[model samples]
Target: MARPSYLARRAGGRYFLQIRLGKRAAELFQLPLLRVSLRTSDFAEARRRLVDNLGWVLELIEAPDLEAIGTVFDVRLRAYVDRGSPADERLLAERCAFENEVRRYFTRAQERGYAYQKRFPEIPGRWVDFVDQNKAAESSITRLTARRSYEAGRREAREAFNEGWEPAPNKAPALRPETLDPIAMLDRLVQDAVGRRMAQLAPGNLAPVAAPTIVPAETGNPNEPAKSDGSTATTPDRMSILLQEFLRPAGRKRQHTMKGRGEAEAVVQFAIDFLGDPRIDELTEEKWKLLDDALPDIPNRDNIPREFSQTLFQRFKYAETHGWKDLVRVTTTTIQSRYWGGLYKFLDFVIEQKLYAGPRPKFVCIDPENLAPLPRDAFDDTELLQLLQQPLFTGCKNRLHVWQPGGYFVQSHIYWGFLICILTGMRPGEVGQLKCADIRTDGEFYYFDLRPFDARSGRVALKDLRNLKTNAAGRVIPIHPILIELGLLDRMQDLIDKKEERLFPEWEAYIRKDGTVRWSQPLSKSWQYVKKLLKLSRADLTLYSTRHLMADWLDNEAIAQRTRDRILGHANDVRGRYGRKGILDPEIAAKIEALEPAVIKQMRKMLLSAKNRADAGGLTVLKTY
Candidate 1:
């Protein structure tokens, strides 16, 4: 009953280990045996130890062995690839963009299995399959020979699969994860469950881990043992709060400004809801796809349907405008391109803010071909004027309202406001903050310097400049001779003579509501009211429509480039001369003086033409989003 002496004998020119497995002969990995001498003292101890090691090797040859080896390799790859590996500091410290991409890869992997994975090129799941099969002894033999360890296992597996892609009938059920490292295997499963839980509970919110500083969470299951890895993950509520904090307004340069913090909040909220990994660094593409799918399902209750409805909604819109809309829309590209740029900006915010770690966001395919602009005649010639000429004093029923009978300029506040936008293209906030004092009429020349309204959030001061949408938006429009002929100049001068500093203050106020002081808001309700009369095509009409209409005329026909630039108070292609205090305002005024009634007449004529055209030209009404 004695086991044979240990010998790796070569009958042919090859290497082999004659494993003593209960009288069976298994020639593993094609290794040739060199010695099989049954000696006493020379090979006695080797024979004894070989039997002991054989027992150890038999224990490792358990079920699900390939998966166990594969998992370890994956962990090692993670460690090697992490940028923070050298410093040993990777606690979700990555940009949101990169994290989003990684999540997308994993989610896709789970859905379609390993064959569909599209991450880095080098790594493959099949390599893990090799080690998981518990054929390392064969692998070691292969290594000793000319081939690799895993290669031998793969070869054997392939041979077996060719016969039947399953274990023989009498074999044990797979040990799988437990065979390689049971505790670590279970840990991975638990993390995956946690990932699934957070994704389900709050889309983008990740529950926290109970680490050194944090108190342990009170669990739903008291009997469940504490995680073997010391740290516990986040809960949904805490993550949401953190995400909100991250999106809250910071300073003037923040993506969201006071005027449009609502949209900014919405963008950040979208990031949070999609990526559930509140660490921001943990966000990935899979989360965004999930969130993207979820967004359309959430009802939009605003005039701009996609824009969320809340006090904070405007802020988010305003913020988005700064980066997304304003920047892109100014270019002469298609509307879809502009919107794509807007999406790009939001995706960057996800990255910059680390809503997740990875690359730039992966967007679903949006057919840019679907986008089309409002017809040129949609807001052309007569329609704009007809919309504007309605009585200013009238209620919000139509395009124009009836004005109240009173003092010359005082009674004409609303009319004058629309007039200013038509002639000068000043925004609502600019008009709301304008002062009669700022208008200076010297001889035949008249000009007004617009300044941004200064506001504050708590103790933090906000910006003051030409409160136009962007830095490029600042311009000084000249008074038209037609405006002079219509007696609008005389009317404005009359208001100045009366010593009224502010042209309009009816809507502006500082309210002490419930002891908290707050500034009055801008004129959007009025814009919507105006939208009724201007019932230009729904897409073509907005508070900004007047500005767009006027600019087109001014730039194309009415004024020469130098004269237009001068009238608009822009420097004459001189950059360095601007910084000096001695730049003459008088020169700017003289330029504005050169502009005549030609611009006004051309604008009016264009409007008249547009009025005669058919309105059914574009799908402006349908594209509210």
Candidate 2:
């Protein structure tokens, strides 16, 4: 879609609504052009804002006098109109003050024209020419608009005086400098009118002025219960406060891990920063609309949640001041999935608690084109050949120097990790964090046990209780015959005999700064190095290609989808829910033994021989591939 000509983009990508004023309007405005910051780089957001404010802009351009322009941006115009009783003292005082200001402007205009006439008696078309020729000329809009106001006020003042509502002769307001600038004068009048409205609508008198249709987010500290004695309590209605209540583990509706809770908190903070700490009661559909509009403008800069030292509002200001050339804004999908999705749950929690009575915000609906999941391809025969030919698979110097070619036929985690994933379709992390006890048997066949660990995975102390990705991830898979033939059982027996807990003791539990533990990072890093060496690295192929390869083999073998899903630890149908222990099935075991990929078959002979030689205390030294 072509960008609108009225919306001009800056070098840094922020949009500005630039409208050229007409000659009469320009005379009123004292400038030929008007520009406003849309406060966004996103084209869609700018377009949405244009649709909302464009009419007001056009109306300002066509406005004959100051009255219309003064209230152009008055979002609370209705509130101002409804403020105070008809005979209110504040209203009468405001009218008296307004009349005095108008008479003062009229006198100032007459004095300026008379002064110009006295100075240039012989030469002039009119006092306007004198004023226009001066370096700092008064806008004709202000003079004409002020004169119109004075004429109107004179009639109103005469009626008020006859009705005995006269201003005190001793209490005239102090003199102020003349405001001849059109926009400045409009701002001043709007401010005075709003002040009177606010005073009349202050707490103890009436409810505060209504907000723009904009929704407000929860922020600040949680609200405390009022005293039982029934004294008034200051309500802690900020979004930050409410978000804490929702995230509190004991009272929370849904339990999340530390990382998950952190992510949710970040989302709430984002809403708070963007929409501000409006009380829960202050939220409206329009505030939510504002949030929706601003979501796309959020830059997709790296290290968010970690490096976000400033609020979203501050970031927008920074971008507007500086430039967004180095940043890439988030997509609508990101907005819908992460930003809006997280907030949806929060709003739901608020409603559930009865803290807010507003309608819930709907999720951001978006088209599904270009939103396909990333493709992970199975490793082909040639790629497998290249991988098996690497020194880590064939022969390496030592465990630490796996890249260097030597006589060391060490069958460690590095050697067995990829093979296990390919044969059993177990996740790399599950394989990496395997315990010797996790490899179990039911008299006839052995299988791998996969479940969350309480405190330890092997001898390593976990940062927290290690968790599976989903409930279905906790399952058992029948061990392939290739693994048994390749001495996986012997490796487990060896670890048990040595009093080792973990199957792969070399892989230490890695704790991140956020206190999350990772088991597969070391093996994944090694895979990358090996892939780089063999020139087999690509977006579609990784350690996960092994799982995809196994899935493909199972599909070719005519395995039922449910059986395949069960074997691969995917969420299952009715039967999966009944099995509490997840022991190996005989039919599943037979199916697992029935299938064999050509890539594994080609490398099987060499791998088995290497394992046998390593078991017999011998070495297969290799100087070259």
Candidate 3:
């Protein structure tokens, strides 16, 4: 019934322990009032907790140095930095494990009714706060138990008096005296533990430790400190480190494509080589402009102006003399989109991590005049015929062999894979990553199941999984009669017999450093060989041109725009969105089959020629299509 002391109930119906700080401590710690929640609804319990809370406040005030009160949070942060040190790998790993344990322990304590944020209002909630709150709660509970017993005893005595009987002497329970300040006791425990850890982690140095130096890019010069505003700045986060962190699974929900990652790495490497591998904070607008200026000189494989081409050829010759090989050229769009986009993304991460103090830079835009014209994507019928007649597509001992023809039919998968792409509007990757199981039969129709699967059976890595470019890419495409006649089902059966999960097991998966598997690498290489042998002059007639060719074919056949888009894994329109996505309708399948007769006749001619050669060599003849 008495007015609460410094412990008062707020509008939330919970009690708070309010204490006004002195001028010196307030300025040092940057707070005026230390208003911590007692974390109780009962007034009596609040009063009891207030005693312990006030003790901690007094201890803080009396301390010689505010920084001396190092918490487990500081220790954990220090340990994280140490773990990145090349010199103390073993010790740092141990410290990291210990830090994790401490974090988990405090998390459990929080779950067990310990109020962290409420108790330490000024300081960020950490393991040390959890420990203190837990200890204080235990002490309060003990006092509560004693207080309840004493009250019960007083009630019994009142009952005895009402019954007109004299109460027994010394029978009443006595409330225990407050022997120790709970907060002070916990503070001692936390400080002692933290002090021991700090000494172990960094012997003799009681001062706060700085964060560890981030691992720089491959081309990064570690000795060079980041320059900021014409002055040497503190070692900023490395660009490579920033990019790696940006690509981490937790950083973003969507995974980056291999091409995207390659572009990012290329830009980062260029930036480091050109700009001396400075910290992310050092990636100023001026530095970016330098990169932009250099982009034009970086020779691109794509078409360029005659002057630029001559300059590139001369540079190539000069580089050949110096033994430097495979120099990549960046286009204006590559600079504006891939390079600038990568830098922009990295900058975003820097800003998000609060490492960059500079204002956000605008995205690099290419001038309409500076942008190079893109080449045609679709291959002409003559080019497509040339592609079909290649040695790899006909029959070969090894698909990789430039000219050897007299061997077992080892290139059937590669041959059919390309043929399938030309007939159906499928991506190269989609065909390359197809498993035996993906060649499914539904009733009278057979189709390729271009859908993702759980590839976590240790047989294949995540990167090896059939990753689609987009949601619409996961579709069922009915097998064209040309593919079926080319023994596509028989090929799947052969793979199944060999216990191979992938239909194109011969086309080995190339797992990238980042754990992304690229099944299309071998296929891409073969296509390059095919293009070179056939003397294809059009840069746009790359392996992806198969899909473009199909687009052209379907368009020529006067197929619906939605149907064409659906077949080629393009985004669907409003009407197309109404039905089940990625599932081919029976009517649509019939229409897809309509374009197969011409393709079948062409494949039949090529197979017949290969069969005749095999028969002449006394080799087993391939089945007639």
Candidate achieving the largest TM-score: 3
Q: Write model 3 residue lDDT over 416-444, tens digit each, in one string.
A: 66777877878877877788888776566
Model 2 segments more than 4 A misplaced: 1-237, 241-259, 277-281, 297-337, 348-355, 365-372, 451-466, 510-518, 528-537, 575-584, 612-625
Ranking of predictions according to TM-score: 3, 2, 1
Quick one: best lDDT, which candidate? Answer: 2
The TM-scores of all predictions, comma-separated, are 0.41, 0.52, 0.53
Native-referenced Cα lDDT, model 3:
0.61
Model 2 error, position 481 (Å): 2.4
lDDT per residue for candidate 1 within 145-225, as digits (tens), equals 554566788899999999978865886776655358778889999999999887778856655665543333332222223
- Count backbone overlaps in model 3: 3
Task: Please count the clashing residue pairs in each candidate, in the order shown.
Answer: 77, 14, 3
C-alpha root-mean-square deviation, each candidate: 29.9, 33.6, 25.5
Using lDDT as the yardstick, the better of models 2 and 3 is 2
